[model samples]
Target: MAWRRDNSAFDFHFFRFFNSASPNNTMSSGLGKNAAGVLNMTIQEVYSSSENWILYFQSGVYFIRNYDYGGDLQIGVDSKTATQPRLLKRNGTLGQQWTLTKAEDGKSWLLTNGLLGKDLFLGLDGAKPVMTADKTKGTVWGIEMNESAGLPAAGNDLITSVQNLESPPVSSSSSSSSPTASQSATPANSQTAPPTTTNTGLLTSPTSSSANGITSSVEQPSQSLSAGGFEFDWGCCGVGFAGSGAGGKD
Candidate 1:
């Protein structure tokens, strides 16, 4: 079976693809190591901050992206002589699209780029840090989930604030039917009104009042903005793998 983008919730899950040749080493973009510009894919021991990636599903293919740096894994040519895997910005190009087929081992996946050629498979070249797609030298990768990569749900702070606002503390002071000396002296139309609450059930600001020598203030909760969804921001520095490899266009 082949893997294609489905736009499902599973697409957000972070994963690490371990090279079958070296189970302890996985693909890394080297973002945590301060690599910049176009980066060649390198292998490293699983590091949630750098090794975890999101197979962003879109259209009919997957755009493999670094979980932290957000750069898409792509194929680039070097002087028209060598083709290598690179980490670059997502441009929706054919070079950035990939498909995954389950290997015969039943536990590993064979990654291929149809645009490059159906025969070319993504794999490391011996012990080098570069990724190659030679027909005879492709890698089978073991996919595993990184549970710690999950992020907090969007708008959670807003929900909790609304819940607390729904039940305001009941006023403990009792009301008296008879009017006081000061109340009788003041004209009914000239008396001040109580503070107004907004439609969101939050006070505009803190307020205090004094009546018959007694003073009290309404407690207010800190305001928070609601977030519609999570957004990943990529910096100028690209996350490269552990080993140094050939450079390509950014």
Candidate 2:
């Protein structure tokens, strides 16, 4: 039972702030519908500050996101790594290109852009709220009441200004490809007895490996933007993970 930091009160406060800025039907101008699909929040909602969805999984409604963008999306994580939790936008991509999958717990729903087949869940452990995956339990996330209901149906054009705080699917961890040259070769002495195989080994491999027989030894170099510049390399596994500027510019 991991212990949650008790942000429930804080989340409630955040919700009130966001709720105040919205209306029954925000699509005042009215645009094309979900030809692209329906997503969780609108780009407009994201930037409005007042309309941002609650992005945590406590007892209230929460937001979940997935970086299943054909492996794109990047964020300035730190000097060495471009955070692993950023979602890049598709060209001509609309922010509201997703739909919500109502869960058995009607209040909770899975937000998907209508492709890549995935859902959202609350990462809680033992009664304590934690930020990790629990494939069996469901992201178990909820939003501020019926905010999701307020969203337009399948054909409605989605609004921008929104972003979900969802995690990639449990399947994502299973299907994702881990880079060949990732971690520094763990010292033979550093190795721990393998845990149950049925479990993810979080240490298992994601993608393919190099000719060097699965690049068992790799080092995360000091992270810093190259003299060239600092930007996200969406099409690739991000510069930080691919090795300094792996997908970056020269």
Candidate 3:
């Protein structure tokens, strides 16, 4: 699959504003504008240049985010959970240290010990496992690897680690019950979903957004902070960077 993205998939129906910042403050608030305000940011898939890179998220390769819970992986069904992160650490256990294993299809991938359910997602194609806020109990979540960016420098390596870790602007919960922890940060489904803001809103979604660029469509809004909103920096520039195109907060 080739890299194709539209900045108009993010939904702001339940969106609400919690705070309002000025050019002087430059600080973000976790509050929302509506009952369920969404965060403001862009989307860039990870792709590879040499062979198949990790930047291509749709290809099933990515640098694990939030490496604390159970995101580690090894090979085989009998594999056990390891101790550290794979890409960043050196002696991280096998469960924590894994490399992408692309099947003959060149699309589906199998994680070390990941079972989609009781048996793990088998021959899982298109959708790749990624680390996100939902990993409060584990170390990863579902994500499209190749679709983000990075090319040639995809996963399990530093090159593909491009701003992959840089989260967009969002509110953080100071309490142990931080709402951002359980948040999905992406959209859930298509049916009954709100309109996409990526190309639709023209970069005014986040209220912090301007009208000079494009943004990534949020697939899930897995967060709730006193009804306030949160935003993380989904790194992207040039072709699809953050600017006025986003439906940012006003």
Candidate 4:
């Protein structure tokens, strides 16, 4: 779980220091009487160091509390009425628990009640926030982390800071996209084989002599030769030759 690394004792001291430094409710002013107003008031409270609803995300579990409001504002359900959420004390009840579901846009999130099948949203008719079955823009909220919350500026920065001390160091093999052993060992030109050699077979024939059908062996000069898959032609070897096989020999 990603969390504050400070010892429990130190955490307690830190919380006390910040809580004491926070401003009181009397400091907030010029706010309306609705959820928007509450958000503005909370933001003002944060600037003034006043204790507001402190939202925490730990090990995927979410908790929102405003100690100044006498305890955590739990989602309490009235038995008689339809399941309408109201603020109550924190007693580790399921109804008080919530999970933050991020929206299609990364900036906003929907806070869903753990026990009741309802989402926290700003009711149009009332100044207080409530829970409903339907999700809407009113239900979406954005949370910003501050240094007072014991978190670094960036989420990745937080992960990097604790990476070495809290968790095992990430191996270079796992972090890098280096070439594999086989890929590095193979030569690029290995796919090309040497040129091939082919022979058309020597051509030989007997020519008939003009005198009484006597036959004579044809003596031809070197003609076409196949080397490296290419044919090379040597013109007639003898200039005055006029025999049947007098052309270039193979």
Candidate 5:
């Protein structure tokens, strides 16, 4: 089978590959590294900033590159029988080249590795990213541009852009936990505890006020600290704290 370039389907821009089966999960280069120090590929909720990929089309196949580390490594399988994909050094091999075809659903694309005449496709095995001949598996993928990363070098006008895929709704827990102006004005001595690590290994610092829905993971100081020569009366949600000098302490 002759490999044909599908230029209209994808562009030479950075993108995030989201699995239609798991909307929240995207293609990630896991923390695990091989002897070459290259990261392994997995499908999971993005915890850090290294998940973006760039689909660079050349000759007839697309070279799927991990944005942050694409300069040295590209996505490829270890061997013809290997199931898991990894970020390997670009060796100009067919195993690193992938052909993307639009799935029947019309919203997702199927990534096929036509290495050694085997029509293995990139899919998810539970949370792991695997390659298999079964198309019925979680092989359909929806791709969206990494808008924050910006566009590619201008001048390549032949590249066609894919429609923006609907992103999963953001949860309240994903909201920014940065300190507010008032919180920043707190005395230097009144130090907030560092964010605690969750079971999933994500660090979160929350500070919330019951009066409002705003919440944060930042731990407030338990001991009362005076602000502006006035004793502060702390309350739940770290709000409604009154000072004795300005008003009667709660």
Candidate 6:
């Protein structure tokens, strides 16, 4: 499925696929935005190059903002009992901010909320995805960027250009859950639901990316902070090595 910014509707087909109440059993707050907000997605082939998404933080934290509402992936207020994630307005609120950290293995990244220190996990065995303290195999994410998808590194200086934007605000939360236990971040659909892990299985090589001038050079020191009682590095998650455009084999 090719996802182009010029698409007629939302950000490709998955936007509607997940928004609907079908195979994707996850709960949605509400479909707020009908059109896909400006989406700049790219697919890479090799495993290491896929980790090159760190620059997204350099520019500013991203909301995991799905097309559902132009909304963000937020931690529900009742974290203790109902830790289920939701979609909310992109007002730069604390709960919506997320950091993509490089897990122990160079393959997967951990998605942690800025406000709530909980890790995002997809429910396996027909369970709905939720944010919780469970560090089971479900929490690790095997992300990949490739050619099949239409989104690519169309312009140069894509990463640097994003650096100009203001970062999201930091917020405190009552949820002090610690990081979940480590698990192999493989592209396994058995842990996280297939719907959410479709791209995970697509791990490949750096066929292309919007990050042209964004070299694999060292980045500015990142700010360290404590959120929801857990200490973590802000904007300093894992960084990926530069790769060739020809793409490598699986």
Against the true structure, what is each candidate's TM-score?
A: 0.50, 0.23, 0.20, 0.35, 0.52, 0.37
Number of residue pairs clashing in candidate 1, backbone atoms closer than 3 angstroms, sequence gap of 3 or more or interchain: 5
Positional deviation of residue 100's Cα in model 1 after best superposition, in angstroms: 0.9
The C-alpha stretches of model 6 lying farther than 4 A from their native spots are: 1-60, 67-82, 118-125, 152-250
How well is each residue in 49-115 modelled by candidate 6, as lDDT tens digits? 2212211332234334332221122222234324444444333344544555555565345666655
lDDT of 3: 0.21
62-116: candidate 3 lDDT, tens digit per residue: 2232111111211222122122112222112222222333323332223332222
lDDT tens digits, residues 1-250, model 5?
1111222223333566777555566666654232242343334424233556667554345567654453346677757437677777654465665666656654456776635223677887776678877776788876655434433332121121112112223458766322111221132233232112111211122112221211112322322223222222222111121110111100
Q: What are the per-residue Cα lDDT tens digits for candidate 2 across 1-250?
A: 1112212111111221111122221111112212121222223332222222222221112222221211112111122211111233322122213333344543333333312233322222332222233445324333332122121111111111122323333454486421111111111111122111121121122232222112222222232222111222323212121111111000
Candidate 5 lDDT (Cα, whole model)?
0.44
Clashing pairs in 1: 29-239, 29-240, 30-239, 30-240, 31-239
Backbone clash pairs for candidate 5 read 205-217, 205-218, 206-216, 206-217, 206-218, 207-216, 207-217
Question: Which structure is stronger by TM-score: 4 or 5?
Answer: 5
lDDT of 2 at 55: 26
1 against 3, candidate with superior lDDT: 1
RMSD, every candidate, angstroms? 25.8, 22.2, 19.7, 40.0, 22.9, 14.6
Model 1 TM-score on a 0 to 1 scale: 0.50
